[model samples]
Target: MSNTSTSSDTSGLSAGATAATIALAVVGGIVVIVIAIAIIRCIQKNKMQARNTSMQITSVSAVNVDSNIDMVTIERFLADIVKERPVRFTTQNIIDFTQNFAQKLGSGGFGIVYKGQFPNGVQIAVKVLHKTQDKRAEEQFMAEIGTIGRTYHINLVRLYGFCFDNTLKALVYEYMEKGSLDSYLFDENQKLKWEKLHEIAIGTAKGIRYLHEECQKKIVHYDIKPGNVLIDANFSPKVADFGLATLCDRDNSHISLTGGRGTPGYAAPELWMPYPVTHKCDVYSYGMLLFEILGRRRNLNLSQAESQEWFPRWIWHKFEGGELDGVMTNCRIEHSNRDKAERMCKVALWCVQYQPDTRPSMNSVVRMLEGEEEIIAPTNPFQYMMPFDGSSSQWSESRGYSTSTATTTNESEANILIHQNQQ
Candidate 1:
């Protein structure tokens, strides 16, 4: 009986052990399955992250490709230029020439200019262009190379070479020791003689004439302010800064401009308006420049009296009133320069004529300034300021002049008409 009882106890103990082992196996299997699932999910997550990173990289590459398109165009243009001019320089060359950009000469909206020297000790002005999102820097770079790169003139600034690299872009120019013309015109301490100023005016006109009539493609120097005129050590003027310049086929009667391209006071009215523009727009800007040169003051100066606030209007008033001598005296013109000053004043009036066709060609301007061509008395350039009355020989003072009755007349008659209208 005792043996049988012991056997039953042993059997029960073995059954309990077997059931516990089975339960443990089931739980272990579940844990292993859950771990496998977790591992798979983690792998998928990693793959998704990698795909997203690749997509982002592709998007960036697409933008780079677009940018590269412009770069390629510029490179091709430069490559062609290089074949003829040998004016291409590497980024390392730029660094060497500019000595790591040690000497900063000036800074402007475009970028900084550094004084540089070559291996042979020839000095240069390195204009490093600002990187812009709008690609204006690139456009200006192309314009300078396309226009001035092909032409050479005594009065035009010389572009020595250029640096176009993946991370840098710059223009190398001949250094002008005397600096820009505005330094002399605006600074009282840096005064130039009237005779010298007259010569500069002629030189500038000749440069413009060359651009207008001589170049294979007519280049309109959209910005012709005194700031763009550089003076050499000998005080010779050279037209510089062709960033705003545009080239048009000579056969095109009017050039299509996307937008205005000059300083406010110097910009032609037609530039702001939706009018058909021609190289005559440059003539208009040059006229504004002449007014500044005549007074050695800005065209628009609020510091002066109300009548004298706009220098061009003041000159017109004095000129129409037969007080041009007063105008000359006010400008402190030398006695010997009175004739030259008068000619400049007349040329300016004609240049600013409301009708572009009435304005003389730059060739005629050169001739007139040199006293080789006759300057017919300029009709009122500011006729819009004084409207004419068709019923009578007078201009309407209240509302300004009528365009229909505007006619070309001699200086004496135009002055009389203006005086009568004032009365």
Candidate 2:
């Protein structure tokens, strides 16, 4: 009876072990299937991610290609249009000419100007443009090449060649021995003779006249500051820095601007506003430049007495009060140069008139500066700054200006009013 009982127990244990083994196998199969499915899903996810990454890369590459093509097209168009094609130099040539950037002439917002030389001992100023993510630098480069490359004038700086490599972009220009006009005008120690200054002013006016009237297309040099007027060994003035210059059809009454394009103190009132601008805007800038040239100092001098704080305003006061002789005396003008100085002052006033139509053409300015044409006395250029007190004759200190019937109590208020009017 004991043996039979033991046998029954053994049989039951074997059956239970078999059932447990079958359950374990089922669980193992399910786990294996789950792992295989997970692996497949991970592979698909990786492939999808790779595809997305590739698509993004392709999109970025396409954009880069388009930008490159646009630049190339501009280069080709400029080359074709320009009568005298400037020499296209390689990056290595730039490095060699610049002597690996050994002598830096100067630097500005655009880039550095390095003194360079050619094999034949011809001196050049190589302006290496700053690399930009946007196309502004490229646009400016093309503009300089397009405009100046097409024309040649004694008063205009000459662009000899250019390097438009992927890594380095530069412009090769004829070197000016005396540097910029501002160096002499602004420096107390470097005061030029009034006669020379007058000559420079006339030359600058002629340059502007050429741009406005003589060129096939009118090129308005929007930034006509002293810094842009370069002088050579002969003290001859040449207009430089055509980065802000724009070419327009002669028939177009005005040109549209995306934004203001000049030094603040020298910029026209219209440039700050959204008004459709004409070449007269350059006249206004030239007027501001004339103010600086007249003073041999900045337009705004806080160090001066209250009466003479703003040079233009003081000059206007003196001019209107029939004390232009006093202004000439203050500027230390020689007796012989007084007529030229007075002419410059009058021309400046006319150029800065609020109404664009009222401004004299650059041709007229040249004629006036050269004493070839009579300069009619200029009306008050600061009419915008006329006092609120019913008197139209004089500027009052206590009462500020008016813009379109609204009285502005302060300069800031006046600016806002002017901006609103422009809008």
Candidate 3:
């Protein structure tokens, strides 16, 4: 009887322990499932927040683009981006390629560019954006690459790789041996032949046409001065420096902008008017640039004897007087040269028409250059301008301010303002 009681009690204890163990296991499983569900919900919420933030950013950019993003924000955004097409490079790689960035190519509103060579004998140009506490620099870096990466054309600068490690930010591009067009345009020492100049003009037009018509989105190059046009060894022109570029839907013909953009001389008049900008702004700038190329000098000259009259207006006066020879003394009266000069002048005047709608599209400009369409005499670009005596020096009077400041103090301050406003 004692043995039977002891066995029965032992069996009952064993059953109770097994039941308690299973209960504990079930409670633990419930807690694990609940925790996992909470984690998943948290992840979903974070994703939603990110999407909302992106929409907000787009909205803000559409309304007013004040400056580029700060360093921290750009670093984070670049980290999250998966760039499959553009190759990524480390800071060490860039250092090795550039030989510690020894060969300085040039400096601009953006930053200093360095000439680099790879082991494969490929030469590259690395543009390092100016660093600043303001997030606008970061925004410009991203904006430039974003535009370049998506664009592919023989007339457009090719991007190879990028580096964004710590404080270093640079864009690697195929080097143009001949350098910027401005270097040669104003260089009396290396004057390009008339044929070569015409070729460059057409090639540049094709590039701009591509940006405006051929791309998935219409890209407006806010700055189209000679400095931004690069020339390769073969004298082929490729458009570069997209710091002030803006992308719009293919269907949309215009864009709303807050402040101003482009260099003082090359900037369209509408930019100063603070009107709604469009691709035509580029046409207007191209007109100004063409005038520079034709005259082989800056359009506005403060020190000239005729400082009051605008250069374009002066050129128009000479053109109307039937003395093209007097306008640009260098342009000879030879048959081919005269034809080319007259065509370019007419096209430029059309481009710089005070009314934005009067400006021809890049495609039309290309056709006009090629002599495919009938050329019409353009009205004077500055016909409506009233001479200002600097009497009323405020608001509208500021437009007449000389873009070229001789003093160092004013130049430095103007440069800062230009960098903030343009590419």
Candidate 4:
């Protein structure tokens, strides 16, 4: 009996030891899990704080020169960018590549572009900025470097490198063999296929949409035109020239600018007024560009035949009159492309709506172009007039401005009359 009791006691003690070991392990595991979660939360909080601080510093630095940019921060940002991008070239390097700047591409408001070929036989377009004493050139240089340098898209022009030595500043980009879309679209002999034009339009829209919605920051191109749209060797459209770009927080609906930016005819009508601008401004310019692509002519060709003096007006007249077949007869749009062509016209009209609110987002524009969404007929863009001085004489004296009269129901006719009156 004594031996049996001793064995039972030993087994009970062993069971208790095992149970205690497992309980201790469970407690230890719970503690470890809590520590890991706490660490993760603390790290996330620190990161959020860092981002907020960086944004605050950037906002302040933009307005105050005394508050110098965080060089360390900029260097880090540039370091990450350089990790995957081409290195910055010296002015001498650019000169060597360009053969002493021999082949000039063209000049713009900011600078001249020259075609350059590297020793490796790779070609590039070197945009040499015009030296300026004012802050405009510096602002533009910084804007382009900061915006385009960080962005990468097949539809967006690629900035291979840049140079900022002494007074010489330049941006080197991928060489576009076909040149600007503006050059070919209007060439009488170089008529682009309707399918090709449609592809160009959709590609351009995707690029803009990416800028507005996909980028880390919301970028308003502010200038979307045929001149800014470069055609690659494959005839694909690439959005270029970020000189007029403005950045805003992604969550923000609109941004306020002191003054308007963009080419006159292509600029949104609201840009002339004191209003907060949005990515919609780009939409308006794209609308104007779409119209030009469809018409195969400049929107404001005052010297063209009377019917086509203002391309938008002429096209609008055709659209309203249900004469879409004759709208772009010169382009030789085929029966299959007729629907595509008409959809382009409808989308263009929607984009150039008098009110920015009425315009569809670029994403929506893409869907309509892709035939995913039904396009509604846009209202007559000119039926709604810009609020000018409330007198016809003042309107008449304004040269190109006109009043809304019942007889002038057609906006195109009104613009035609204005052009004639000015002449």
lDDT of each: 0.77, 0.78, 0.74, 0.77
Per-residue accuracy of model 3 over 120-154 as CA lDDT, tens digit each: 79888777666642465566677677887788888
Q: How well is each residue in 287-360 modelled by candidate 2, as lDDT tens digits?
A: 98888888898776656787786688788889899999999999999888898999999998998898899999
Which one wins by lDDT: 3 or 4? 4
Scored by lDDT, model 3 comes in at 0.74
Per-prediction TM-score: 0.71, 0.71, 0.70, 0.70
Model 3 residue runs over 4 Å out of place are 1-85, 130-133, 307-309, 328-330, 388-423
Global fold similarity of model 3 (TM-score): 0.70
Q: Looking at model 3, which ten-residue stretch has the lowest summed lDDT?
A: 413-422
lDDT of 4 at 349: 88
Q: Kindly list the per-residue Cα lDDT of model 1 for residues 1-423, writing each as its tens digit.
A: 999999999999999999999989998999999999999999999999999999999989988998899899999898666644528899899999989998777654556678889897978888887765236657877888888887788898888778888788888888878877776787888899889998998899999999999999999987676767778778888888777688999999797877656665666778767899899988988898898889998776656776876788788888899899999999999888999999999999999888788888999999999999988877888877543222433212111211211111111111121011112
Better of 1 and 4 by TM-score: 1
RMSD to true structure for each model, in Å = 24.4, 24.3, 20.0, 18.0
Using alpha carbons, what is the TM-score of model 2? 0.71
lDDT pick, better of 1 and 3: 1
* Global local distance difference test of model 2: 0.78
